[model samples]
Target: IMEYKRGSTLRRGQWTAFVFLLMIVHQCVGDIRYSITEEIKRGSVVGRFSQDLGIDVKTLSTRRPRIEFEGNTRYCDINQKTGDLIVNERMDREELCGQRPSCALLFDFFLENPLELHRVTLEIQDVNDNFPTFPNEVIKLEISESAIKGERFSIDEALDTDTGVNSVQGYTLSANEHFTLSVHTSADTGKYAEIVLEHELDREKQDELSLILTAYDGGKPQKSGTVVIQVRVLDANDNVPVFTQSIYKVSVPENATLGTAVVTVSASDADEGANGELTYEFSHISIKTKNTFSLDPKSGEIKIKTMIDFEDTSSFELRVKAKDGAGQAASCKVIVDVADINDNAPVILIKSLKSPLPENSPAGTEVALIYVQDRDSESNSKVRCSIEQNTYFKLSPSIKKHISLITAVELDRETQSEYNITLIATDEGYPPLSSFQTITLIVSDVNDNQPVFDEQSYSAYVTENNKPGSSLCYVTARDRDWRQNGTVVYSLLASDVDGDPLKNLFLLDSKTGVINLAGPIDYEEQPIYELRVLAKDGAGLVSYTKVLIDITDVNDNAPVILIKTLTNPIPENVAPRALWPWR
Candidate 1:
């Protein structure tokens, strides 16, 4: 079963159990491979991805199927809604794989939520888009008129970039009486043609020979290339130079310096004097070999002319020819193998990335797909990947040389919104080479925090009989979340004070949280008013705070006067006592 667990949950294990059943089909059926021809139209469906994986269509939103390429170029993409894997860009088999026999593009199909990976091999079939071509338009050779029958001369091979049957298969020589063609095939170097002398050459009768050599490929259209072979017959000389060895094998490090001696060739001639004396030169070598190495005609010494890089060309094969003063020649092949060195540093490629991740995302959420590449061979290319000093995120080994960056712990956007994660890759070479790539991760906010008031309760004093619609007191609240989730608004909760709604008596500003008097109040009617103010965030998370308003009395009532007794008649009658009753 393939499973990635950050913390612990039965849902994850259940998903793993589900995928484990699919793994049976995946392993038994081998890799999820698809074949498509070169230059396929973009958006063309390659295969049904989710159906092949036995994944449910309803869960595609959370699964988030995606494609991750091994190289920088992205050729295919997955459709989450339809479950179809479609071509993202046009592809050229010749441009992508060159002359490789099996042109397969290897990549991975990544599914999120449970974070499962399925390896996919996309085979790009070749097309007969190119014709067989020769390096040169004309091949020139010299031969002695006395050369006998059955003598063979080497011909430069034609090249075809297409692989398999589309490559050069055969050669045709224009009808000739003096010479015929002999085709040879090698496991290392494909097919090559040679010229064989069927009849003895006479310089007096024929001074020069011009023949046409045509090369054909096995393509459906059967395209071919043609070149002219010019043979110059010279006066007879009996001596023929022969090499000590037919083939020479040599090995040198790719870091070998220029002027480094690779090999030497020696030949002997049976004839004496001018006919026996021989000179050497390179013959029938490709442009790459000619530019890299040089040969000395006098000493017959071959030396490096330019630095050799194993990454570019691991080995080279060139032909060396020795000719006597009579123009009789013989040639041998020298194969130089270049050894590898740990010179290339590991490279980090981010195939797919999910940044600005929602802070509320689960622990096992896959953040990115990373791949490391080292151009060196064998142990030098083996690499170890890691994340530097990170606890919230960790690297999980995936399909060969690929790493999945996943959340190790739950994240809180309020604490840290941004993280700079550094990924380091180190190879297993003797003097280990290393490289690092830093990724910037952003944590998006969620409505996890509720609005909080500045104080638990508030107290304000207001005079009785104050003007209606006057400012009473202001209450403030703050939310920790960002953007719309952090926005807070205020309202007076519905409650009855003396069987009347508090909102009817007090007004709370939705934006500013300012409380205003809705109606007139008197100390005799209500001296103190108790109300609850509620704060809510944009996501509807709420908090409540109590507000107490004290009303002070004012001099608004006039003093009352009461006449206990009638003093008009008693004032005239009484003088000293002044205690007069009207009765």
Candidate 2:
């Protein structure tokens, strides 16, 4: 075991230096490989990244080794504390690789500082976590009493997700005198099981035969699955119904109405009376095909029973069986090729939605996740999702069939607090079908705007010697924000007019923004009063304005006449003496 120092031990300055060096030179050093079993517990050590790359623990830590892989799922990570590759998430081999014989996770192991990149491949080994499965629990087989020995009839095969020895190796049949098991292996189809008749089936002695068929995989404590085989023995009726053709092919539009006949299959029997009268039904057809088409027993006409979607299934292979009165039957294949139709409209499904988005959210912030689907074939199923042009929100393409709704610009609750985001999805079909879905998003308010007065400054006149507590004038302010954030309150900011506090002379109503005279005013003393008022919102945002009040003068005093030193009497005496001197 090799011990390596953790990446956390590296100094912050070293990491910064490494990042700076990485920008100068980046190179691929080569590749490394490892083998591990799937479904290991998270945090299980996989391999030493530093040891495998021939780098010292200190160097690895300084470089900050990181793993980069495809897709969103992170299966492994380099432990910073241990310099070891650890399982980040439990992986299922079957789901990761499906039926592929070899499963490997390929990722790039990058180191900063010196800037070296290495390709790391981890081969995941199977652990037989899943058991073999049969398509159904019961399989019904019809056999005629006149059938000869050694005749083989195909049976359903068991499926195992695990490959190689861990897969379904062989099948076993219950001991029976009438039937035996035959296994066949082919490169194209793999292995399949069949029932072989060892002896002729007798309808009188045994009308029904129940047998067990078990399939097992070659593993330690092997896993197995079983299906009950029910063989129904039929009475002797030699003549079998023969179809007009062994294979019939037809094309029907996906938009064809229900009960529209596609084709009529005719079959005839040479036997007379009860043996010649035949009935028709679907045989060995998939559930989807059977549900889409129905067969008329008497007319042998195949008609659409349910709506067919060309996108889900482009074509269907149906086996039609014609059985005579005595249980003799013949089957023919009907291939129905569904024609394309631009009938399905695109559909939008919301995966995640975040409402009450903050007004201060930056551009490109994800608001919602959406998925679009169209149930039509080929070009008709190709869909494009979009929102209104020049909107605050736009649809961004994400993973397949997924779209992200992100803000194109910052939001402001004062401008538009609530948004009805309409998303439209359209297919690429001729005369394309489109559909729309609307998402309502509300913008949450923030303390972004300060209270603003109706006018920058206000002035009101008050008479001199006015009574106390008189309503001088009202100050109105408005805030654009909503709820408590926009609630405005008024106050007279502390200020001095000739060393007198404005609050002592004037009063402000906090809720209504009303200014009133707190005390008596005299124009002879203080002719004009300059007031500064402040408006504040509940969120603590404040604004200020000026208010000037000029007091109007009234006739409050009487005028007094003053006598100058003997001027009035001297004027009258001079006028009389001037007259006497002239005489």
- TM-scores of the candidates are 0.76, 0.54
Note the residue pairs that clash in candidate 1. Answer: none
- Give me the runs in candidate 1 sitting further than 4 Å from their true place: 1-100, 104-168, 171-183, 188-240, 257-260, 274-291, 305-307, 321-331, 558-583
Q: Return the TM-score for candidate 2, rounded to 2 decimals.
A: 0.54
Residue 102 of model 2, lDDT score: 88
| Residue 184 lDDT in candidate 1 | 93
RMSD (Å) of each candidate, 1 decimal: 7.6, 13.4
Task: List, residue by residue over 1-583, the lDDT tens digit for candidate 2.
Answer: 2233322121111000000111112244556677898899999998998677677887778876778654458899988766899999989988787666888886656665454445667889998876777766787666678878887766666778787788888999999999889998855335668888889987888999899999998888899989898888875556678999998999999889999999999999997887789988776444456688889999999999999867656778877778777655677878899998888787776655668899999998778756666667677777777786547887665432246788989999988989998888878789988899999999999999889899988999989988989998988889998889899988887887778777788899999988888887888778888888889899899999999999999888789887544433334545543633211
